[model samples]
Target: MRVRLVEGASLPSYADGIRQVYADVFSEPPWNEDPSAGDRYVERLAADAARPGFTAALALGEGAVGGFATQGTVGFATAWTTPDVFPSGRSYGHVAEALGPDRVEGWLCGALEVDELAVSPDARGAGLGAALLSAVTEAAPDGRCWLLTSVHAEATLRFYRRAGWHQVPVSVPGRAGLVVLLGPGHPAARP
Candidate 1:
């Protein structure tokens, strides 16, 4: 599959397909998110696209976007800088504590944050997810990138590990099942 890195501002053209994939992938077990969640995601996506450093990769197949990965520099005057908007409220706090108060915003704001990665259920196992993941994070400032996922999604956890992502051990309050994964060059990576 050819993965195209769509600048966030240009993502509106692919919005419908991305929303369909988001609804399809997240509606299943482990996520079991409501279909309406796709609507909310689309709403947030529109806002995220306008922020600085916003980048999204779209997996193209049969003239449609089969999967997508959205990312941007954290704390870049986007809604993402606000912790309460996330599905897991404590994720921001966890990363903050793990990186320490003085360095938390500095580090995160300078690093690339993968906000969402999803492949349509019908499009899984085709490497679209991996391709999108790689393409989306390839331009991180300071070579750092990070994301959070549900620990209960064993397949997703395994996939990230297989792709060389390291899971951060920090515990997130009110989100015991969440796991933070850092890209290879992230400061928290093990030696």
Candidate 2:
């Protein structure tokens, strides 16, 4: 698989691939996201692409168009700086409420927050997800990067763990627990 970085200026060309990967991955099992969720994400991607520090990693197959690979690889990852003034919309509020101001600021603010990562079911188990993750975060300021996933997603949790993300031990209060993970090289990561 060939992983390439797509800056905000180039995100549109890959929107369809990103949307498809997202829907394919999230609409199953733990996420069980509705079809409309993918539509919402594509819409959100527009605004998100304009954000400072926004970056996307697209893992493409040979001859793939816009990156929805027909050559047996399709995956992507998106990330951006955690804004100094984090928004309260979406699940950010839940994250803020769960971790509180101190942890939020100390651990998250200014870090590269991975917004989404997904690989087509046919393309998983081949290190594409990890490569896309690294491609998006390899240049994180001070090696500070982070992401979150549902506690119910054991497989997702394991994937991040294997990639060396350190899960914050605290449980996020909600219908489902949200687990925060610090990147491998994060200064605060525990041994």
True-structure RMSD, every candidate? 6.3, 3.1
Question: Measured by TM-score, how close is model 2 to the native structure?
Answer: 0.91
Candidate 2: minimum summed lDDT over ten consecutive residues — where?
64-73
lDDT digits (tens) for residues 115-179 of candidate 1: 88887665567677788888878777666777878888999899999889998776644554777
lDDT (Cα, tens digit) per residue for candidate 2, span 79-185: 99999987787678888988899989988999999999998887776788899999999989999999989989999999999999999888776776788899998
**How does each model score on lDDT?**
0.67, 0.85
TM-score of each: 0.80, 0.91
Off by over 4 Å in 2: 63-73
Model 2 Cα RMSD, 1 decimal: 3.1
